[model samples]
Target: MGTTSNSSLRSAGSITDVAGIEVGHFTDTRRPTGCSVVIVRDAAVAGVDVRGAAPGTRETDLLSPTNLVDRVHAVLLAGGSAWGLDAAGGVMRWLEAQGVGMEVGLAKLPLVPAAVLFDLFLGDSTIRPDAAAGYAACEAASVHAPAQGCVGAGAGAAIGKVFGIDRAMKGGIGTASVTVDGVTVGALVACNALGDVIDPDTGRVIAGSRTPDGKSLFDTRRSLLRGEAPKPLITGTNTTIGVVATDAVITKAQATRVATMSHDGLARSINPVHTMSDGDTMFALGTGKSGKTLGMMTLGTMAAEVTAMAVVRAIRAARGVTAGGLYLPAVSDL
Candidate 1:
């Protein structure tokens, strides 16, 4: 197993000691355009758990612990609304060619897991990633690790606005890692939170709802208490999704536990998370090389921290976009 000293670990930028995990993205900048693919680790044991009431998810059934496929070669996070789910077919095709899939009598079946978020981009409806785009993403996965912020699933992602887009903030993909006793666990998130992204340690809003002048994003609770009419606008059509990868030896069941625990990190970093307007989902992947021993609950707690850190990283790495005469800047850009 790869190891790094605890004393040398850092939280800013990319954390140290996170090994074997690789990320890749394919982005289309056209209107209703977005990004795809966030491979956590090569040949990873993976699982998923969803906690949103109005989630628009796909491939969740494959995460079951009893599934014959014990490992997932890649995960695709893309923007194309529900229609974009078709992108996974391309990934499946690629994996089939690589001989990475479930083996039957005569042929191998690909077991690529995928998830998506709706970025309709003001109802341009025609916009979304297709099978070709998915293939492009798979091709891109062959290169260096992914680039965060305003890319991939986050390309058209925005946050805030229980009110309207005027208060939405730019949110994208962010990553962070931590090491404990020589074991490294890292997280990457595609943040599209309904609530503002906050620094858990400081309780300060780093991103989320913001005024046109680039002021504080509105608080949903405060707005409700003020008797403001609830805007059912498509403003909060967001979903934050990503993976937690570690070198630790973990089973699919344990990975499921890690995915469940990671939600706490979302709750910590984003206010009023797991809301109806948000299709929040998380995945966990174990690379099966870190010979560290950890209790299920302890690993869960670590997952939460790493998840929160990844959310913050995504917010901080975001960039501004001009939409509807409004300048929506990323959390860090502001």
Candidate 2:
């Protein structure tokens, strides 16, 4: 990647910093589960990687390089596990109303791919994201920088579940951007992990499992060193879903590679990530606005780097939430 000053990177702001993208979220704070949508005002070449063993995804197969649909109109990340997939319907409706989609003989089909994280247990599972919520988010879509932490799909997100819900910390959405040689890459993450959250720059646990009394730190990596199984007071309730976008022109295959590489950020920040119980997934989008100022390899590398930054930012920006009789601490508490 071409050299970019730290100040420039810091000033790049959220994923919307990439031209032609609009983001919005519809949250039900009372239920603590919601949905987020990234509306590509201009359709973008997209690719995805689903690393977690139990992922709840929609239309991901169509994103393959060999597939017919090379560009996507929107990508959604939401809470409520598989049930949240319904939110995509609302996105489709919104796009269709705007007359943005693939042309068929009589009508247009909006291409929207979505991923869902398990947040049902965090609040009232009965109240989950639906088509109404999705449409609401789209109506609220704007190029304005997105709000991070404890918002959108991450409203009920939590991390460091290796010890259990009681010890887990709160996690939410975060965004970061870096511009190199005119090419801008940005990332947005909803971090609800099965492992501890570490600040990659500091190599320290910033927010994660804590002692029962909530006075001391608990490192999940150390527990794994002993090769012991963890008995989570709550199980099968975590995932980290995110999007990485760039203005550089790149092919769908290259975007797929970028998506694969972006997972490095998750590995760096989340210990024991992509676990069987988690549904970790990422999407890469190339808007082709800046030509090819950055090489594919360099762009992919920066995608990973910014992804890590976004992860730390998510933890730092997150605020704690108490639901279902459990208290999840935020990074500020640490």
Give candidate 2's TM-score. Answer: 0.95
Over 21-112, each residue of candidate 1 has an lDDT whose tens digit, in order, gives 55656677565346566543357788898876557666678788988666877777778767777888887777777777666769876666
Return model 1's CA RMSD, one decimal: 3.0
| Top TM-score model | 2
lDDT of 2 by residue, 178-266 (tens): 88878888888999898898888788888887876887677888876878568744345789999999988889998899999999999
Worst 10 residues of 2 by lDDT: 1-10
Candidate 1 achieves a global lDDT of 0.72
The TM-scores, one per candidate, come to 0.88, 0.95
C-alpha lDDT of all candidate models, in order: 0.72, 0.86
User: 167, model 2: CA deviation in Å?
Assistant: 0.9
Which pairs clash inside model 1? 35-152, 174-314, 209-217, 210-217, 320-329
Backbone clash pairs for candidate 2 read: none
